[model samples]
Target: MTELRISQKEFDLFRDFIYKEVGISLSDKKIGLVQSRLSKRLKALGLSSYDDYYYYIQDHKEEEIFHLISAISTNVTSFFREEPQWAYLRENINTIFASTRKIRIWSAACSSGEEPYSIAIFLKENLDHYKEYDIKILATDISKKVLEKAISGRYVAKDIAGLPKHILQRYFDIDKRDPQAPYAIKEDLKAQITFRMFNLVYDDFSIFKNRFDFIFCRNVMIYFDGSSQMKLVSNFHKILSENGLLFIGHSESLTRNNKEFKTVRPSIYERI
Candidate 1:
């Protein structure tokens, strides 16, 4: 098998296409990264060149666009990637749940199942009389590939390695039969979440009829350019409940000029 190379023209075409379609700003340095990542897709499709794959995606936009985004997007996530946010949640659990027993949370850009599952676990552990409250967690991502895994609710040992023993025993079923995916999320916890495919940049936000109490768009906006980020933040503000909290990636922040939200904590914003 010969290594496929992407020309500068091909790279530029993909760069513009990806940004237009998904709001991901690819830097010049990402040419090598894009080439290496997308080459696997070309091989799978039996396409010989990056140009062929590019046009193929145009013709087959509905299905292949997901594949294109999946190929280029990095889905690095864990059960509890950020500790400060969780600690804050723990401290303010009562205040957050005071108004209503009904809780709506959107784990936007939820890579794999870890973040949503963690939310479920956290709520179950922290909330007294957990069964009395109505909890619905919407976990969505741009990649169908990750959604499939999330729906399965299965994980290998290393995937759940950071979880405490009691949490594992309480929420996960130890599957000795399947060594590959030794831990399976219990049906009760899995029932609380709904996984779907969503493109934050391109999708229609009008589809959401209900506002959310919490929106976790963590670590995802770094890929978008400034304008796209601002647009996304504004959309989040519009869809959030009156006192809703927005949690973003530690490395990301809202611009000072923006007035839709006020900084509640580091990387956390409250709807204003």
Candidate 2:
């Protein structure tokens, strides 16, 4: 088997394809990264060249697009990723929910279930009479692979090493059968969340009927260009309930020209 090398032209083809399909802007410096990641994919599909894989995806796009996105995108996430966001939520939970007992949250780009599960645990711990309210958490990602792991709600010991002991014991059922995946999220926590495959750039937003109270789209917009980011922000603004909060990645911010939201805190914005 010959070593597969992607030519500069082939790399540019992928760069344009990815940008048009998913709004992710891949720079010229990312040629090596793309080649390294997609090489295994090409091998798995028995394709010999980058051009072959590119054309292959064009014909089998519905399924292969997911694979392409998964190959290139990073899904690095953790429970309670941004501490200040949690603190802010804790401090303002009452005011945020003052008008209604029905709460809806969208964990946009929620990877491996940590973010949504953390929300459930946070509500259970902080909200007085947690069961009395109508709560639903919608967790979505572009990759089906990650969504499957998230739906299973299982985690290895090391993945959850930093969590508090009581929180772990109360929320996770110990799976003694599989030491590799010892911690499984109990039904109580899993019940509140629905994991789905979603592409923020290409998916139809009209499918959403209800407005969410909070939207967590952290760490994802950085991959997108300025136009894509603004489009996503607009979509978020439309779907969020009045005065609803949007939490973006620590490194991201809504541009100054944007007026649909006002900054409540660093990386936190409220729909006006």
TM match of model 2 to true structure: 0.94
Can you write out model 1's per-residue Cα lDDT over 1-272, one digit (the tens) per residue?
65688999999999999998888999999999999999999999999999999999999999998888888888989998899999999999878887689999999999889999999999998987788899999999988888988999999988998889999999999977898788999999999999998889989999999999999999899999888898899999999999899999999999998889999999999999
lDDT of 1: 0.92
Q: Which ten residues in a row have the lowest lDDT in candidate 2?
A: 123-132
Q: Each model's TM-score, in the order given?
A: 0.95, 0.94
Misplaced by over 4 Å in model 1 are: none
Residue 90 lDDT, candidate 1, scale 0-100: 90
* Top candidate (TM-score): 1
Backbone clash pairs for candidate 1 read: none
Per-residue lDDT of candidate 2, residues 1-272 (tens digit): 54578899999999999998877999999998999999999999999899999999999998998899889999888888899999998998977776689999999999888989999899888886676799999999988888988999999977797999899889999876897799999997899999998888879899999999999999999999888888899999999999999999899999997899999999999999
